[model samples]
Target: MKYFLWLLVSVALAGSISSCRSTKRIQTAISKKDTAAVVPVVDAKADSMRFIHEIYQAIERNRIDFNTFSAKLKVDFSGDEGKKRDFTAVLRIKKDSAIWVSITALLGIEAFRIMVTPDSVKVLNKLDKVIQLRSVSYLQELAKVPFTFQELQALLIGNPVFLDSNIVSYRKNEKTISLLSATDIFKHLLTVSTDDYRLLHSKLDDVDVLRARTCNIVYGDYVNKNALLFPTYRGITVSEKTKVDIVMQFKQVDFNVDLTFPFNIPRNYKRQ
Candidate 1:
């Protein structure tokens, strides 16, 4: 009876836990009519500013209930030009709250999954046929993700991605706002093109090297479904003395999808 209950719950959360956002609303927002209206305006800069503010205000005002998302990633680090290390992987994010959900990454010949709730985290590796579970606070230290949960949530919600928002500083002008956030880990400045609200450039200060590097993170396409905008392509280039470039092309994403925790282990699967 317990096994049956667990299956029923997992099925509800995992099936169609995937959904695409609504694109029609985005068409309405950026319609040809809106663009046409701006062509004749004299205070064109002001008008564009207002329009972008309204758009971003809408984005900020809007709420996201992103229960699940799918992403494809291509990561490359280029301190050395002699070799290029690359891999293709798909990841599924399932979250019920700020402290709960699952992340499953599928790579060639291996399946790695992590389930984190308020209390505990469980990592499952199908290739090794082992399951490891531990307390949440302890697991946070063990996590190897490039960013923290807060950062991930921000990215997932289509908001400005910052490693630390609490200490960020900002300066605004008619055309742009330069924001700087610093920590012992790293420091960076972000310039947002006011008319577009798109980040024009981001620069990170390298403490050890006693220098600065400009970072380029570009948004390629956004798909809007059900009042949410999702970026489909992302490219980032790190400019030090040398340049390292990485690009990610997303195949699909579903937000506000179902996510539930599993309550039972299959008899065949090993638990550790």
Candidate 2:
């Protein structure tokens, strides 16, 4: 049951132990030759600032806003030991309030039901008939990094996490733009489409060089619904000592819909 909980939280707080390949690619892209004639240093600096501002604006323009969000998801998880598990999950969230999830295993048997809020974490394990409740800090402990309910909510809803405006550099290709920003906690490299500014990928590394923690996220298969563009698929890779991969495909999704979070522990279940 503890392992199961760890896997769930790890997926929500995705990071990676992967190499710095993406960083190298961005550096290479920035140094690529430009066919356009060179301009004065002052004008070039102005153009760079304008470009950065435009990118920030585009990100804000595409941010998802809602009162409530719900989705049916198909999740595939691969662990470090080469074990794989596939399950279906129903997720519901109230903005800045709560997140509820139900995971079902083979033969439609409900395996776990979880509810997380600003202050606490609760889990009901059907297979073991146990209930585990702990303070919100438990999530941070499980992920080995500071985490918050708001960050988890944003991750599930396809919003960028750990993003900062202190952009140090940017690189652009014909189709995509990559911005690298550094903050106290993370060095975040974010990539978005040139045409619509839809998120394409994100790579994060801990600012402290010795920690050796990294995460990579990819977004794809966007669909327009209710006048909003949403990504239906996400791929996450988190690594430090070991690697864990998670893929989420949204089978159905809706926003600003009335919802309920039902969490009732069975009387006979033992508290762990």
Best by TM-score: 2
22-106, model 2: which lDDT tens digit per residue?
3223223221131011211222256787888789889988999889989899877777788887778898999999889998878
Q: How do all models score by TM-score?
A: 0.51, 0.85
For residue 73, model 1's alpha carbon misses the true position, in angstroms, by 5.6
Supply the TM-score for candidate 1: 0.51
lDDT of 1 by residue, 24-117 (tens): 2211322223221122222315554564455445434443556666555543323326444444545556653333223233444535555545
Question: Would you list the C-alpha lDDT of every candidate in the order shown?
Answer: 0.43, 0.74
For model 1, state the Cα shift of residue 163 in Å: 6.5
RMSD of each: 12.8, 6.4
Candidate 2 least-lDDT 10 residues: 31-40
Residue 189 of model 1 has an lDDT of 49
- Model 2 regions more than 4 Å off: 1-45
